[model samples]
Target: MCRLSGTKSKKEMIRVVRTPEGEVVIDDTGRKAGRGVYLCRRLSCLEKAYKEHRLERSLKTDVAAEIYEKLRHALL
Candidate 1:
């Protein structure tokens, strides 16, 4: 069996955001023209992302409560 080291084997958690105009996508390239938030694919990252509003800041817009809920559901 092949075992990977720490962080390398971990799944990279990225944020997929849907715009008000309805665009669902991953913002890895950081050039998407809509709101975006990032997570480390970990529960902690998701929580922190919400608490700190990292996603909102990244996307440069105010996020809606429904969007937050959706993100939480998707992350979990």
Candidate 2:
């Protein structure tokens, strides 16, 4: 489900995760061991999540700027 839009979408979504060792990463395989949050693939969803700190709130950790950078690149 998208944390921002609150939708269970069939469209591809970005999976951001905070690992057990406190590392935040994009879980391309969707099997990473950690707390994870989903966002819609649209740039709008990413931007809203970034600006509103929604991802950080959901993951319970500080998300890095580079993570958003990577997500933006992926969305493109």
Candidate 3:
């Protein structure tokens, strides 16, 4: 589910993962080895997650803006 919008449906959401090594990346395959968070597959949800620092809180680490940009590109 999207942390911000509360949207459900795995197929309609994107998974972002924070690896044990502390690297944050989008998990396109959904089988990555790490703690993961889900967000609605929309720019608004992405922006909300970034702006509110929800991703950082959920992953228990800092999330760089560049990673969000990369996610945007992948979603597009």
User: Better model by TM-score, 1 or 3?
Assistant: 3
Residue pairs with backbone atoms closer than 3 Å in model 3 (clashes): none
lDDT of 1 by residue, 1-76 (tens): 0122355332355655656675555555556676554456556666676788776666666667676676566767
lDDT top scorer: 2
Model 1: lDDT of residue 45: 64
TM-score, every prediction: 0.53, 0.87, 0.84
Clashing pairs in 1: 13-41
Q: What is the C-alpha lDDT of each candidate?
A: 0.58, 0.86, 0.84
Q: List the residue pairs that clash in candidate 2.
A: none
In the range 16-66, model 2's lDDT, one tens digit per residue, is 999999999999988899999888888988888888999899999999999
- Best-to-worst ranking by lDDT: 2, 3, 1
Q: Specify the poorest-scoring 10-residue window by lDDT in model 3.
A: 1-10
Which has the higher lDDT value, candidate number 1 or candidate number 3? 3
Clashes of each: 1, 0, 0
Rate residue 11 of model 2 by lDDT: 43
Q: Residue 64 error for model 2, in Å?
A: 0.6
